[model samples]
Target: MSAIDNLPPLREVIATHQLSARKSLGQNFLLDLNLTAKIARQAGDLAACDVLEIGPGPGGLTRGLLSEGARKVVAIEKDTRCIAALQDIAAAYPGRLQIINGDALEIDPLQHLTPPVRIAANLPYNVGTELLVRWLTPPDWPPFWQSLTLMFQREVAERIVAQPGGKAYGRLAILAQWRCEARIAMSLPPEAFTPPPKVSSAVVHLTALPEPRYPADAATLSRVVAAAFNQRRKMLRASLKGMAPDIEDRLIAAGIKPTDRAEQISLEGFCALARELRRP
Candidate 1:
């Protein structure tokens, strides 16, 4: 039995189910029940929160969330081969676990979840960033979930919490930091996975703030950030010229120098410029 549950250890479960990590689906299963439980703890007080987990190969983290006292866990896995394995977990935990065999990108998890929801996943690498973007860019100020604790390549995790003036500081940093308190909560070596990925991984914990740190139209700010970082090497005056005819004046009015590059500008600077551009 695994340390966290009566179910067999993950390797045994994988062997019985004939499950192998599929590169096309970006699967790298984490097999250590103890480690998986540790990752779940980073989400903070899951006792009352319903959790949404993605790509739970062999149900390593699924068991973790349940054992860690999550009120309920709704797991979405695209791999049909792993359905039976996850079903084993559902049986073990009874109603505490819900397994959905579908592509996470296509399905809306909100229907299955109650409020006070938190998302925790050892996400499939192929769709991780896309999923994070979707969560961060919802139309409303306060999103459906209370928090997101997710695993990503170390490089990608750095991008989410990166400060201005670094190469990693780009659209993602602006988007996440504008309305959430983001930090890298844990790190794992490549060797931690069943079939280790070449790069290291880290878990990012983000708790949503009631409102954005600075007031700016979300669409306008997104456009401004995208344009600035799309050609990050170019000076603001050159890259953002397409945005407005007098873009240099707008930059100065926003308290930014015309020659400054995107990497040098803080999130507040971008929001300020976005407000200026929104002006008639």
Candidate 2:
């Protein structure tokens, strides 16, 4: 039996179901219940929250969330072999567990969840960054979820929390930090997973701000940041030339030096530049 629940241990369940991790699906089964519970605890109190979990391979983390007393957990899994495996968990928890068998990239998890939502997952490596960007750039402010507790490669985690002027700071750093409070909650070694990934992993916790920290249109800010970072080595005036006719004047108007590279620009600086681009 698993330490956290009466359900079978993950290894035995995997053996019985012949559920081997597939590289193409970015599957890395986390078999340690102790570690999984620790990950769940990092999400804060789940007692009153409904969680959206992505890529719940063999339901290891799924069990962890449930054990922590989450009101409900909606898990999206792409692997068919794991559906029956997760059914075992669902039965153990009664109505608290809901399993959706489909691609996480295609499915909109919000439709299945209600208010007071928190997304907690050990995400598939390949789609982790894309998913984060999608969540960060939602059409509306004060997004559906109260917080995000997601696991990503250590490098990606560093990028998410990186400050201005650092090598890791770029588009992601601006997008994540401009409107949210993000931090690396914990780090895990490669050996933690059944099929160890070459790179280590870390969990990031991001809570959305009631309003953006600075004033700027999201679309314009994205374009400006993209342009600046796309040619990061170039000075702002040259890199943003395609974005505005009087790019140097706009840079000066924003109180930014024309010779500054993208890495040197703070989030507020980027917002100021984006605002200048929007002016008639």
Candidate 3:
């Protein structure tokens, strides 16, 4: 039995099922239950939350969430091979675990999940950023989930919580910080996985704020941020010239310098620019 639960150790489960980490699928199984449980705890109290976990290869984090007292867990797995192993977990927890065999991007998790939701996953490296963008940029304020505790490559995690003036800070920093309180909760070494990854990984925990830190139209902010960062090396004036004929004036009005580059601008500065651009 594993330290956290009665389920067999993850390596045994993987061997029994013949599951190997697939580079095409961005799979790196976290075989240590104690470690998975540690990652799960970063999500905060799960006793009242239904967690949505993506890419739960061989049921490591799935078992972690269950053992940690999550109210319920709805796990989405794209790999068909991992279903039977996950079923073993479901049986151990009875009604608390629901395993869905499908791609995370294609499936709508809200159908299976109830309110007060939190998402925790050791996300597939290939689609991790894309999934995070979707979650942070949903149509409305106060998204379906209350919080996100997700693992990503250390570089990607840095991008989420990075402040202005760093190479890592750009569109992702603006997008995430504009709407949520984000921070890196934990870091894992490359050797932690079954077949160790080349780079290290870290977990980012983001709690949704009731309202955005600064108010601006979401679409407009996204457009402005995207445009600015797409040509990050250029001065704001040069990069944003096509946005409006009076782009420099608008920049000055928003308290931003026309000479500044994208990475030098703060989330508030970007939101202010978005507001100015929204005006006639």
Compute each candidate's TM-score over C-alphas. Answer: 0.99, 0.98, 0.99
Off by over 4 Å in 3: none
Q: Candidate 3: which pairs clash?
A: none
* Model 2 poorest 10 in a row by lDDT: 1-10
Candidate 1: lDDT of 274? 95
Q: Which parts of model 1 are misplaced by more than 4 Å?
A: none
For model 2 the TM-score comes to 0.98
- For model 2, how does the per-residue alpha-carbon lDDT over 48-150 read when each residue is reduced to its tens digit? 9999999998998999999999999999999999999999999999999999999988998888898899999999998999999998999999899888999
TM-score winner between 2 and 3, please give it. 3
| Error at 195, model 2, angstroms | 0.5
lDDT values for all models: 0.95, 0.93, 0.94
TM-score of 3: 0.99
Per-residue lDDT of 43 in model 3:
95
Cα RMSD of all models vs. native, in order, equals 0.6, 0.8, 0.6
